[model samples]
Target: MDTTPLRVAIIGGGVSGLSLAYYLQKQGGEAARPIEVNIFERKATLGGNAETVWVDLGNRRHPGKPDSPYRRWADLGVNDVNLATYHRLRTILGEIGELERMKPLENTESYFSRDGSIALTDDRELFRGVSDPAHDLSQVDGGKLAVLMAVVHRSAIELVESRRITPRYTVDDFFDACVATPAEMLAAAAEELGVTIDWQDPALPARLERLRHTIYYPRISAMYFADDRGPGGMPLQAPFEYYRIQEGGSPPDRRYFEHGSQHWLEALAAHVTDPSTPGPRVEILRGIEVEASLSPQGVTLTERAPGEDRWEADLLIMATHAEDALPLLTFGDGLSDTHRELQHILGKVRYTRSFSVCHTAAARLPPNRNLWRTYNIEVRNPEDTFFPYRIDYVANRHQNDAENPAYNQAGLPQYFVSLVDDLNRIPRREMLERRPSPLDGPSALAAAAPGEAGYRDRLPPLDSDLEAKAWTLFKHNVLDADCLEAQEEIARYNQTTARRRFEGRQDVCPLLFAGGWTRGAGLQEQCLEQSAQVVELLLGKAERRADPLRLVPTGSQARQRHPQARSFTSVPTGS
Candidate 1:
């Protein structure tokens, strides 16, 4: 006899949840298992922060203003999904023998480097279609590839040697660190890696923390073009094909999605739902304001749909933010401690404010001169007067394939640049760069916090530090740090950098907690990487599988499954 089709409910239609749904569907195959998947999007549309709101339909991206951006704007920054994530995506496609139909995203292949430049990155083997083949990847000219490779090498060493990075050492002790930063951060990183610090600044601790997470989160085994650190920090390269295959045989386009990295989320959802498949159905609900509650009978989600008094779901999978979900989760589940801890953690989360200005214009990229010149910049003014962050240009992509559909999106000939500078000292400059300049919409500079210090304290337990000891030693240090003043600044600094508080907590959460926030220190790439990871995990057939529509989707089954969700209650599910 067959088992009752496990109903799996995935919340949040954003990239992470969507990726999970896609992978899960692929693993089960069409009709292989009943997966009633429901994706709940708070926004009226999908693509969480990745979605772009087209302000003016007719107006061009720029009215020829000096600082006019591209014809469109994407709030989140992400280009390519890394090799590890891409590997699973490819495997999923291969399993179904539908890999050929997949096409590379247009304008989604490159990124502007820290130095006001553009760089191309892509997996050559995975290239179903390459739009804008000649896309300008500026970092190649500067030999960023070497730096990147060095980083991979260094990460392998740290992961194998120390197993756990210590606070006093860094990898720079072994390899020459390239990415420059405040002296103190660089130094702490060096120390943690068993290296040394080259610079100063109270901000070092936060950067050190970020650097460590970058080197060895989820283990180095999952990295692309990276040899697992050998027993002696000298692991021999296996057959080059093994490494090259992971590279996707494609030339690098540091940034791949010209419109930002949210498109994959949509693509994943599309793959999961096929009318022909006889499984738990997939429902995508959007624009439904949420009120949550928890109880003895799982969880409950209630919403007011169009002309409907109430809607409900059972066994909800909170794919949204941990912070937003904190209050929404009910303590009645006997997970009250977890809820309370999470709530306190969210309170301490620190983040950054983001801003952008869009303009409509028609300009083919890659000036007639050397593509390298496209990276050249004058800073416009460094005195913190009018410009708050670095200024960059969007050049015409070098590799525009006729087969690429997004060429039209690219052909719009637009530019969108952003800046992440000293939030404390750049307001005067930021004010001058404010919006209303023929761009699409208002420029309030959306600000969001990243890390929660209170939540971070819990990491020590998750890190295995509290298992045998029964107490996390780091907690003592955190509470008793010298000059809590400097620690606060470092915390503040991180909020503006990558702006996600989730990086340090990865090894613990089996279900991926993803977004621009958790995508490592590089906010955009990390988030995309996370979305990709869930794709692999879901595809790998992760556990805790229930009806996908158990909560987020509609109908009585959902109501039965999640009677009380998102709200506190006396009926705790746990004893």
Candidate 2:
């Protein structure tokens, strides 16, 4: 057996794989043998979809020298984001001492639900500010009110789980299980979390319907319980699984500002890479398409440099999104049965697209407020205002002159806006041309839609063992979080993806999978999270196994992030 440093190949320069490469390099300090890692990206740039893109068809102008704030630039995709990403980012920035210079925005949502003739909003900072244990939640709607009576659900969930009230759930249980309820899962969720209905407000069916419409993001529509497994949208798990998330379970970090998010990615890249360094280098390949093959040993990689085609590694990680990876692959000539089965798994996703109209106000925005305003406007030529979904504006997303010197130079006010919720209606190019995008408006960030996911069973073609092996390697690298029985999750989707690479060292293996699709089904935050997770798996932090823990039938687009992501507990194997 040849014992050499593990030569790793990473395809896709997005967050997941990049983070994986980063951790692998850093973990080298603790490794017995040095680890060698390399990256191959199709784009000419390194950030993949996470980088800031400045696309101008003549509309990219500096905000009226201050009159129209964010009129200058626009992030093509993945901007206004979840705060859970912030927690980790904050620690990173603090360690690097760029916390103050980066100027991150820290904000949280205060939701208030209402119904017919009864509209309420949680607009008061008092709700967030008050530290009373028995405070009133009259303003808020839904069963979340009941859970809050005890403590912010997460704190309470911890108490219940520790005291054995539910005896099975804990604060760290959310992604690993599922839960559901009639009308609205909140009622069942509250009961599972040990919340008591001490106060009196039984609006009966009205409350139930109201809760259904207002509690969570209505678009998600339904909830499936963790222990609901006897059909009718239930899991066969034990009762403990139901209340686990509510009993102090924390949602992923959703507070991190993107500016801060980018800072960390950039810093990590800087820390691990140096153009002049020798050992194993992190070479970012841009604008090069994967003609075929998953590893350099299998196919030829053409680039601007002479030695670019010679790059190869013992280990290759395909961290591309599942959807994007599907088309770039070709199955082996044999094992048609297994290949066909995997096709169904890959076929279940349904993505929707949208355009983010980022605007530097045509006039100054009301000072000091980031808001979502609704308007019914009339545009030029009786066309009826370009977009009337009621603009949800993220003010001061860009730097303000008062806070950062860069904003002072731009002149006007800027707002980073994401106008979501329009998958059903397609916009004509003329519409996009007439109005402003939420990012740079008029030249919006294009439509976006995250679909659902499901699972299937299959095997790799025997004749194309090399392709099978290569795909198997890549599949292991993209297992989302690893909480799922590693073996079962791999079987669920890999047979299909691997089948695409049936021609051995051809494009079959090297085609490389990237993006959020690898995690069953990922949309926005979930996709971004998987991008981080997949990179780790590809880096060898995630180990391959023989079978899944257990298979649970899910929708065509069922997405669940595994537990073995960019996690500190299970340090990846490579570094």
Candidate 3:
């Protein structure tokens, strides 16, 4: 029996990497030997994209006194985590004993902004913001909304059922199974749902645009439609899932950690680094850029700093964002066919950039408590071209109070607005020309059209804000061409290599792949699930016992053909 520990190298220190470390440490025993895990992060902080802000609310004991602000934590990057949708994340939280920290978000109403007025909706999924209490929606419009809902429902079902039977089914495969592009599907569904309206009808185009702007973009984040310009939708070829709405829970019914998303990520980091942890000591190398190379010895990771330190590991796990990991992978002189194949597949994965601004400006924000008594406000503007959508009032004060009574006693107000802008699409020269002062308020960064004065006036005054804006790399492939090609190639690779490789050798070429981008919808749950699957693969999980009826056909004709047949030797294994 080999007792030598498996030395594993993990790239990137985000949730995916952290969770992988957590599982590797916990499940290393099943691998026949202890495991040594080393995590390399390029940034000073471990939690990538999951950033939090601790605001200092100045002293209130003596109004005129000069006292430093109290440090209270709030989220600026990833907003909320859904309990119903994110089961894997929930399980992880439970393992870390932070499950109790999860709380339900307060119910809030959404408003549509058009012609400079806000209209509240009774049914957030379908309706627009209208002033009239009894606004009558045209039958055609109502039918369109119903059809959209049906598609969303069907997509969710297909996603769940497919994953249950074929865990290897990539998200690209899910969308490929759909009937048409989201727009075309909407038009077809309308007819099926009895919506009688000409495609060229004057009102229909506007309705579709509104639906896309107010609902689809935010719900799916432009996954279906490639861009903002009407619709010359992407080619629908890959088997990818769309509009992933988890059944039973409304999308708006989301929960946020009182301390922030960073709290959860930090806790995960502590579990690996803390000396008191029960598992083998995991070394975390921060602020180091590692270049990965392959050799007969194993995986070699060379740091990019002066007098660089080199570390060799038995296995390498690229847990970073696919794009980030692609550049770090260096093919040595005797690269195997598997390494080349993986590099080709990874190249097809496309990504787009998204920019968001987080600021503390209570005066610029609308009321947190609406006349309808909702705790938060979601505002949408279809007319503003630069960044049409914005979440005006994300008041953490209300959430803090609801989660803890002691928090409310402080009576400090903290509000933030996040905008999802497609900065990558805009020209570099234009953005640079329009860029405003760093110290300036929201108006400084506003991309409003000319003569759109007073538009910035509605926003609360920006007192202080995060110095570094939230810039993110979003994995995007609308048509499924890239996803499908990647999936098929990976399927072939897995069948020949990933599945055939025995647990006897620790040195392998095709290192494990794990991230939300590799799975369905690129969500938190997908990230957790994919990383877990990688861990399971590394452990060489045992196959479940086969059922007697499963191996032999139970039909009358089949039973007659093989009367004595009970169960076959081969059994299905869990991944």
Candidate 4:
């Protein structure tokens, strides 16, 4: 029997790749052969989307402690964690001893029109003093509200049914099939209110146009899809399931890590590399771009740079974005038919670029401070078909100590993160360089005057008119219908190849994939689940007690457990 260890090389160091390394080392002890894992990340940092940056609050001091400067850590990319749906992620946090670090957050939102009209707000306080707040539903009229509710109900029903039937349908396709037409909405409204609505009314077309722009278009482009291009664009598409998993549940039990998401990512890296742990040898290679050449014998990996040593691995696992993984497979040597087929499937996946700015930009949020919520979305152009410019998260309320009077003083700046489609909207001079700074004490801040160079260097901009703390740019995977179909094809191919190898076939595919792109909505949960499946494939399933992964209930099962639960709706509130 050959007892030599299996050499596995994994590319990309995002959540999916990091989780794969952790699981592979943990379960390798029980496998038929020991394993050695190598992870190569192009970036210096491990966390991909989970980036955290600590910002200086300038001369602001902690409440009741004048000697201490006020500072906080903010997540630039991935911030909130939905407890109800993130089962695998929670388990991984527990295994790493970071579960208790999660803090609950009140998930509230408000939407504003470009002209600063409060289109909708879920926070009840906004209507505390107003009688018939429903009458204050400015711009959102009876016909539009009726259509929006009908669309939401129909879309929810279709999302539940589409899992079994038209799984490849896009949100646009589902809307066309299930949602009522504008004419139908008008007729229904007339029948319900015992009044006639003339098709020739000059206001009718404008009302219907507002319904599409305010309700239908923003729901698809701004919120769910998160793309600048409307659903008609190829690379900006989202499948039915993508929207279903996001908006299909009751108000998510939202939480954020105490120290930020990168803390747990660093913990996972530490767990895999700890010498005290009993697991396979794991080597993490940072700041290396690897190219691979495959043949019938094995995989040969070499640094993209010249004069670099080439390493050989028996198996290769690509835990990267589908498009990114394709370029890593080199064609210097003749390629196998199976490898070509894999590349073809991978090419089907698509992605779009977006910018996230972690700054103190009050201009991005609603002008009226009273309408603010944890999530404030400003529609810069409500009439436009695509409305993607909005402040996505208010970090001060979501992650910082909002009750601290010192931080919320009249002159102090509030932290905000805006998701923008146009990079030019973010002022470049205001963007702070990306670098971690040590926490400065109050004495350090008081050492410098307002006009001194030391004060400018040590403090973040005190007012929104000045520079911001920091900014970051990232890409989001587009989960369109074509991408979803590609995922299914990859799964089928893997299963068939695995079976052939089990039957003692000499010719077998050596490559496997693990990433959010390989499964459902591209989220942390899907990324972790795919990693666990890869581990099970390499090493047989572990004993029940030793298994670190557990099955998360399906959406229907979760609903069954909470029958009285109201399905959470992001639909703008109005008449």
Cα lDDT tens digits, model 2, 156-272, are 233233322221222223212222122131234345566654323445334434432333222111111111111112111222222331111245322223342333445555555
Q: Per-residue alpha-carbon lDDT of model 4 for 68-151, expressed as tens digits?
A: 545666776677777666878888888888889887654556667657544665543232223233422332475445544444
Evaluate model 2: give its lDDT.
Answer: 0.35
lDDT of each: 0.34, 0.35, 0.50, 0.60
Model 4 per-residue lDDT at 39: 90
TM-scores, all models, native as reference: 0.47, 0.53, 0.66, 0.76
Error of 4 at 524 (Å): 0.2
Candidate 3 ranges with C-alpha deviation above 4 Å = 57-71, 107-111, 117-214, 222-253, 274-280, 361-393, 397-414, 420-481, 484-496, 503-510, 542-575
| Ranking of candidates on TM-score, top first | 4, 3, 2, 1
Which prediction has more favorable lDDT, 2 or 4? Answer: 4
Query: For all candidates, what are the clash counts?
Result: 106, 101, 19, 0
- In candidate 4, which residue pairs clash? none
Candidate 1, residue 256: Cα displacement in angstroms equals 2.2
Candidate 2 — which residues are off by over 4 angstroms? 1-7, 28-36, 51-76, 80-120, 124-201, 219-264, 275-279, 294-313, 331-344, 360-391, 397-416, 420-488, 491-514, 520-575
lDDT of 1: 0.34
Better of 1 and 2 by lDDT: 2
Model 3 global lDDT (CA atoms, 0 to 1):
0.50
Report how far residue 252 has shifted in candidate 1, in Å: 4.7
